[model samples]
Target: MNTKVSRVYPRSLTFGDTTVELATMTAADAPALAEFVKTLPVHDRLFVRRDVSHPKVLDAWIGALAQGHVTSLVARDGATMVGCTAIVVDPLSWSSHVGELRVLVAPAWRGRGLGRALIQENFALALGLHLSKLTVQMTVDQRAAIAVFEELGFRAEAVLRDHVKDHDGQAHDLALLSHDVAEVQSRLRMFGVDDALQH
Candidate 1:
C-alpha cells in the first residue's frame, strides 16, 4: 500500500543504455500509473481494459499486474517512469499461447529507440511464457506506432474500416498487426541484434 513497496524492482532488465529494474505493481505506483493511462491517446486508451481495480480501474489493473497473467513494466530515468509496457498473457485455453502487447512512451522519450527495446523485451517475455503470437493495434493518427510494428516484423493482419465510431459518429479505421516471436527473433539476427545485444 505504500510507494516504498515498489520503490525498486527486485529484478533488473536491460534496455539500451539503461537498465529497467522491474517491480510487480504495488499500491504505491498506482497513482503514477493511473495518471500515465490518462495521457494515452483516446483510441489507445480505449483498447486497454483495466480489470484489477474496482471502483477505479487502474487500482484493479495494478492488482492484476502482480499476477503473471498480466505483467506491467515501467522504465525509469532515476525515479521518473519515462516509459511503460504491458504484456497481457491470455489465460483461456483457446488463447493460452498468445499475449496482447501495449506500450507507451512519455513524450520526452519518443524517438529515442526506447519503444523498440520495450517491445523486444515484451516479445522475449511472451516467448518465455511459450506464447505463439503477440497482437497490437494502431489508429490512423498513430503513424509512428504503425512503423514500429512493421519494423518489428508484425504484418498488418486486418483493417477494420469504420470499426469504431467517434463522438461525432465518424468511423475510424483500426489497423491490427501481429508478430510471431520466433520469426521476429530470427529477423532481428539478420538485422544486427545478436546475442550480445541481449546483455
Candidate 2:
C-alpha cells in the first residue's frame, strides 16, 4: 500500500479523437490554469467551492498544491487545459480518512468521456492515499455528472437545500454523493480487478 510506489503521473489518454496529457498540478500551471478557469461558464463557476476566477483564490489553490493539502491533476490538450480534478483532504481533521473529490471539465469536453477518465484516476488516487471514503457534491441540475459518478459506484449521500448561490443571488440545491473506497477496494480485490485499476 505504498502510494509513492504505485501512482505515477504525466500520463496520456485519448477521449474520442482528442489526445490529452494528464499531469500533477504545479505552480508553473498557474497561467494556463487561470485562463482555463476563466473560460468556464457562469453556471459552472457557481458550483466551484471557491471563486477560482479570482487571481488570489486561484493562487491559494496553487499554494495548497505545494503544501500537499490538495492533490490535483490537470488535463491538457496541447497548451490548453481541458479538465482538472482535486482530491482535498485535511490530515489534521477528524475525517482525515475521507477525501472530497472535485472535478471540472471544459464545456467542449463534456460527454466525450474525459470526465469519466478523470474520475477513474481520482478513484485510484483515493485508494492510494488510503482514503476510506470519497465524496462529491454538485448542483442538482448537473444530472449528467451525477449519472457518471453513480455509474462509477457513487451513491447518494445527502442534499443541501439552497446550498449554493449564483451571481444574481439565486439559491441552488447541492446533491452529495459518496463512494465507499474500502468497500470498493475489497470488492475489486475479490473480483480480481486490482491489476486493471493500476493503469
Candidate 3:
C-alpha cells in the first residue's frame, strides 16, 4: 500500500473565531487526550467501546499508535485537545481491509466544522492506507454525529438493540454506519477525481 497521502498535519482550520491545529496523534499526547475525554459528558462517553478516561485504556491506545494498528489525528487549540479521531485496523483479521472510525469532539466545539474536518482527514488517511471499507458506530441518540457521517457517504449497516450500557447501567441502542471505500474510490476514479490522489 502507498501509505502516503496529502498530509493535513500542522494544518490550521478556523470555525467562527476558534482556530485549531490538526496533527497526527502521538504517544506524547496521552495526557492531553485523557484530559479531553475526561471533560466529555457521561452521555457522550457512553458510546465509547472503552473508558478512555482511564489511564490503562489510554496507554493501550498509545501502544496501538506505536504498533501501527491505529492511526489518529488530534485537533488542538494551543495545548488543549478540542477534537480527535482514530482509524483502527487489525491486519491479521479477515476484515483487515476494513477500518473502524472513531471520532470525538469537545461538547463546546460541537456544530462547528472541526468534527467534519477530522472525519475528512481520516477518510483520506484510510484511502492512503488502502482500506476497502470503513465503519463507525454510536448510540442511536447521537443524531448529529450520525448525520455528519451520513453526509460523508456512510450508510446505515446495522443496529443492535440495547447493545451498550452506561455507567448507570442503562442500555442504549447502537447504530453501525459504513462506507464502501473501495467502491467510492473506483467511482471517483471513473469521474476523474482520483487524479488528485496521485500526488
Candidate 4:
C-alpha cells in the first residue's frame, strides 16, 4: 500500500469570480478537511459516505488516501476548503475496470458549477488510471447532482428503493448513475477538451 504523492496535483481552475485550487488529499489535510465538512449543513452531512465529524472516521479516510486505496481531490478558495471529490477503484480483479465517484461541495458553492468542474477532474483521473467506467450513487431527490452527471453523459443505471435512511429514520431511494469512459472521452472531444485528454 505504498502511496505515491502526485506532483501534478494542486492545479487551479476558475469558476466565475472564484479561483479554486485542487490538490490530492494527504495525511496533512485530514484535520482541515474534517473541519470543512463540519461546516456543511446537517442535511448535507447526512448524505456523506463517511462520518466526517468523527475523528476516527476522518483518520481512516486519510490513511486510505495515503495508502492509495482512494484517489481524492480537494478544492480550496484561498485557505478555505470549498469542495472535495474522490474515485475509489476496486482492488478486486473482477471489478478493476470500474470506479466509484464521490463529491461534496460547500453550500455556498453549489450553483457556481464547481461540482461539474470536480466531475471533469475525476473523469480525467479515471482515464489516466485506465478505468473503463465510473459510477455515482445519490439519493433520487438530488436533482442538481443528477443533472450535472447527466449532462456529462452519465445515465441512471439502477435505483434502489428506500436504500438510505436519514437522521429522522425516513427512507430515501438511491439512484446509481454510470458513465462509459469511451463515451466520456467522446463528449469531452465534442467540447474541445481534447487538449486536456492528451495530457
| Candidate 1 clash pair list | 52-60, 53-59, 53-60, 53-61
Could you tell me the lDDT of residue 47 within candidate 4? 48
For residue 108, model 3's alpha carbon misses the true position, in angstroms, by 1.0
TM-score of every candidate: 0.74, 0.93, 0.93, 0.87
RMSD of each: 6.1, 1.8, 1.8, 3.0
lDDT digits (tens) for residues 85-106 of candidate 3: 9988888889889999999999
* Model 2 lDDT per residue over 64-167, tens place: 88877788999999999999999888888999889899999999888888999999999988888888999999899989889999999999999999999988
| Clashing pairs for predicted structure model 4, backbone only | none
lDDT of 1 at 35: 61
* Runs in model 3 lying further than 4 Å from the true structure: 1-8, 195-199
In model 4, which runs have C-alpha deviations exceeding 4 angstroms?
1-7, 186-195
Ranking by lDDT: 2, 3, 4, 1
User: Candidate 1 on 1-199: residue-level lDDT in tens?
Assistant: 1111212345565656777655445567776776665555555553444422234676556666666567667776767676787777657558766778888877766787788878877765665555668988767567888898899788889887776665467667878889888676667689877453333
Query: Which lDDT values do the candidates have, in the order given?
Result: 0.67, 0.88, 0.86, 0.80
Per-residue C-alpha lDDT of model 4 across residues 1-199, encoded as one tens digit per residue: 2223323777999987878999987788877798788888765654456656778878877878866768899999998889998787657568777878888998888888889989988878877776779999888888887899999889999998988787789888888999998677777779988556545
lDDT of 1: 0.67
| Residue pairs with backbone atoms closer than 3 Å in model 2 (clashes) | none
**Candidate 4: worst 10 consecutive residues by lDDT?**
1-10
